[model samples]
Target: MPHLPDSVHVMTDDTRPHTATPTTEGVWSVRGTRITADRTPEGLRLRARAGAEGLSRIVLRWRLDTPEDARILGDAWERGYGDLQWRTLQPDRALPWYALITGGAFGGPTTGWGVRTRPGALCSWTVDESGIALWADVRSGSLPVLPGEREVDVATVVTAAGPTPFAAHEALCTAMSPDPLPAVGPLVGCNNWYYAYGRDFGPDAVLRDARTVVEYADGHPVRPYCVIDDGWTEGGGSAPGGPWDTGLPGVFDDMADLAARIAETGARPGLWFRPLLSRTETAAVRPGLLRDSGFPLDPSLDVALETVAEDVTRFRNWGYGLIKHDFSTYDVFGRFASHSPAELALPGWSLSDRSRTSAEILVRLYGTIAEAAGDAVVIGCNTVGHLSAGLVRVQRCGDDTSGRSWERTRRMGVNTLAFRLAQHDRFFTLDADCVPCTPRTDWRLNRRFLDLVARSGTALFVSVDPAARTDRTDADLAAAVRLALDGGTPGGVEPLDRLSTTAPRRWRSGAETLVHDWAEPWGAVPLAV
Candidate 1:
């Protein structure tokens, strides 16, 4: 264990010098990361910075001691992701580097920061030191054993070189600096291809026909963000052979006309793009981007990404208000052999080097999109969560559930609920998997799912084609939208049955609201408001 120094934890006796290995259960040591922790008989509560921290720069914040102890616990090792960046914290200003209630530890049924497979008991932390400026209290007997609440503790670790705790705390404190920009009400937007890219069959006739949804959205109480999916790559024309060039002429011209119409409907125009993806299906994909075959093409390279900066600018100026950048993770992993199981897969590139490069690619792509679009709202897709963290304001809280909207909605609903509950504080909004809840089966069930998702955090997206659904269903849809507009608490799932991943007993979606039982996957038990 090497002496790590970054404030990455909170509460309790400081353990700054404790070092951590990049491997899941390796030793963790740090400087003065504030661990805002809650304790239980099992372990301490921990929450890592969602957008803020990757494993690269995190170290447990503890009061430093003799170099003798540090040398004994420290090895000159640098594990994966990012290389080490260290700075000694003058014993006065504790290693507080973030504004998040970082990570923690706990026993059964709690989020795992670390655990041992062999012992099966919460690993006892080796206390290196305790000195000036400690805020944790001593547990006389034991921490209160609350029924529903997991006995967890919190810690704020310095997960990275940028965004210090004081910096974040100050930003949050000063967030309300007088009258700000227009409160961009969460727009009810829909990017057409989510139900299945219309591009597969060569721009289905229906994609061109989706104008009606945009036309209808214009009449809603709030302005909507409607996006034209993949087919209309309006201005990539400069790259004549680029995918954007082949689209129908006057696409933007017609869309500009539609924009005026949408303006009347009080809707904003947004466009969908598989930013990192240029299908051979579409010509935008440069030959170098695709695998000589397909599916397993590498996604970490610049060539694979088609990042034509000017093209993005054209879209922004073209009057598109929001941009959905999709599919950076074209391959799940660069597994060497086909059908390689978990046992066979190797880390793509150098595990040490590639992960950081993967992270770099993410920031660049997102930063590029953000810069290119100015203030246009950006939503990242298929970008494994950690990569898109804080850089993106809104994210697909759940996976993209397109053609199989129902099943995708259900699974994505569960995933986004838990993920958002875990990361709600990271960003302002959660793109709950899009819902097309109708009067059909599980309609009310689906309605409840959407309401729960939005109530917790700002939710953006809509799949109902009001013109298509019945009048009554439309009323319900509107009410759901209204509640979403109003907002509600985020959700968390507490396991009732003994530790099992199959499902949790009491699944709660809000702060102190209601909890539903998903014991048997599809059991829909009703709850009253």
Candidate 2:
């Protein structure tokens, strides 16, 4: 885990300055580091600087005429895009990857990579990758380097040459950013933290899992949603820095009567929180607004953005239609899974709000928890995929999926739905998590991960443990939640044995392609790092 010297890696830092000139179309430069390259309409416009300031990172190297068994896709430098690591370009090996705005380097948020060819064209880019021979990333780290060189608008690197991989991940998610309102339709749900992982539940086990998601949506018409995850408030002896307001006296004694008893079981409640932690022994935390993980808080401080927008306006005045929230880029960069936004050098630390830039204080703390999540439906979880892309509509992306392992739900839900299923609804609605259907896992591999997350149209949560209900059967999780809320199928997965497995057991959805042994009914399990 030492890795960093590829000339000071974190995606090529080399202590700034690599001089490049000759502008007009695509190259400009300065000394302490300043570079640019324009040619827009949505392709090349790479800028950088250090002279008038703004130069924390810039690493560019592109050469094409590609094709050598190309196959790479990226999205998820956080949460759990379940062991995502696909490759092909090894006549000596060189397949690097990168793409970050906040949570850079290793703590996740390397959101970029894609190069496919097998006739069905594709091209996507963003952060980190060292194969296909080096495209180091960091593009911009920590933040606030500005004074001159601009163009690092979310670390510029937008390429979208489509034909397939779902129109090049929906044109690299609409050239990476500005395209939120798709109203994220498709979230067949139920999420008691993979069978109560925060150790048990409440509010009558979260309204008996909202009457088990209204008896697994027996009123189908896409309603579902129960959520509640991360045990309902009050210190359960320290979790996500503990102590969130209201509910939990004797387990959610009344978070608005458990959202009016899960809206009298017609389902649709969701809650979760974690807004940047608190639990310094259950509340009143303010040791000069803690961070560096000592009870997390500091959302670049404004009393932690007025107490996380008054706990997301008291979970949208307690009528919740979904809030989720979770971890805030590991509680605002305290670091996550492996660490890398330049080894957490939060732009040479010295905060308490030095006037923005940790990607504008995480897009103003994810736009103050998406403006107190009014009208609910926020999601995010573990957060930050290019500043939670238009402030989240649902984007867990990957990492947790094992109500007790079918080899950790086929290495985090079939490798994050076969490699970030083209940012499922183009960025936000791609929740690649859940489908635990336990009994200690293995309903012939969780029914092929509930028939590939109900035909992989994305976001298909389902946790269910009830002590593995006598070896599963809520009518087979109500026909996999009625094929993930009404037979989903707008396909495009393809993998077909990724250059030899980082959990690619052959795939191809749109036109039918199959093969699975994800280590057969549970056998191997090693690849966690």
Candidate 3:
């Protein structure tokens, strides 16, 4: 198939400014009548520049709109930890990662939440008439983020300040599930903590005795096996030298204990992992077992996967059920600068191809893992949906993004939901990852937002720390799961009126006082409200 021509490359002309202001910082690169604006939206965006054939990104990150409450973000950026560095455009001019909030970035109103890290990458938390907020992210090598260059960030002169995290005047295209959730079967299960989600992070506060995690799943209508996330092997958390603690040595046995626990709960236990992102340099990787594919070494593909099969066979020997396999896309698509001390290796023949290769490597890795995990309920996160279609039975379609901010609901969650609806029920179940996984601090409003994303009736499972119990109510969490496993909400997602110039639009769950703008396709502008 012929790739689209450069004529299709479109850059919004208005983002350009007639004059430079010291307060303004960003760059404009002109390529054959095409001008690319690489501006920091309050040091808010982590984007990439394409060498003509890659994906160009404009990451307008969605974060809590408050400063103090923004502690969640600090966890990802970790300022006091002193700059977290990594290799980006490695082996040449290395880039260092940093978290910066240009202030007033989160000036918009209530919206959704989430986080991630990278050097030269930035996060902003600020307010105007809208609300309190914070957001940070780094561009992957897939796109070259030309540092020390001029870029433009669009600044709309608003008569009235807004507090929503939604881009100004952005159109939304939402697809309500054609299938009714009201007809699905009852459910019982465990929250899918990825393979990497093991006893990491200073001990498993919740699933300490793998057996305890299983015990909790006993009576739930929706039965999920225990699934652990990253940090299973060697070391993790804030680079290598940092305080790395999570997961025990034995990968298989840990899974075994956890699986046995799931059996006790009358549920299934699943495993989580960013299988494609691993280095053979670590002692964790079994030597000689992994083939030198010359591609970035994915330890899971090399050693971890075999361990799971052996473990599952042990389960088979003892009569254990299926597994939940998970993958995180972020690691596969990181923005590490090569010069950074914390830089991980990205096997490469040439410098420029790093970003593109990581993506290709993931494509290969998914198929490889699926083949290895026979019948396991695999879920993907930070994932590219179409790639995992049919590969994993379930895909974490949105960010595990959770927060109390009302605006959060509209941010990353719905954006991902709307853009990828076609794949909702395509090859596997679409998992709007961890909605009710949130504790029931604020009942009604919380459930509403989650319920809306559970659209298409393909809602897979709900996640919460087994220790994620709430002071508020299981009343809300249980209701959502029941609706999900026992089918879904009575009426299904009740979308609000057309609020933007975007096609297939949606207004999932608005705080009762739902006041908003609809996305209008062929709309006036990108974020022009």
lDDT of 1 by residue, 155-204 (tens): 22111111422232223222211112233455455554543344332222
Which candidate has the highest TM-score of all? Answer: 1
Worst 10 residues of 1 by lDDT: 71-80
Tell me the number of clashing residue pairs for each predicted model.
73, 31, 92
lDDT of all predictions = 0.38, 0.58, 0.35
Tens digit of per-residue lDDT, candidate 2, span 283-390: 333345466444776676777778888878877787887888777776666567432222333443434543334555666777788788866888886765655666
Compose the digit string of candidate 3's lDDT tens values, residues 490-513: 433422332232222445432332
Name model 1 segments beyond 4 Å from true.
1-156, 159-185, 194-222, 231-242, 245-260, 279-306, 331-356, 402-405, 438-441, 465-468, 488-512, 515-529
Off by over 4 Å in 3: 1-222, 231-253, 279-329, 336-361, 403-410, 436-444, 453-456, 460-472, 489-529
TM-score of structure candidate 2: 0.36
Query: What is candidate 2's CA lDDT for residue 417?
Result: 70
Ranking by lDDT: 2, 1, 3
Candidate 2 ranges beyond 4 A from true positions: 1-52, 56-209, 212-255, 258-260, 263-269, 272-304, 316-322, 326-356, 363-382, 385-395, 398-415, 420-474, 478-496, 500-529
Per-candidate Cα RMSD to the true structure, in Å, reads 15.2, 17.1, 15.1
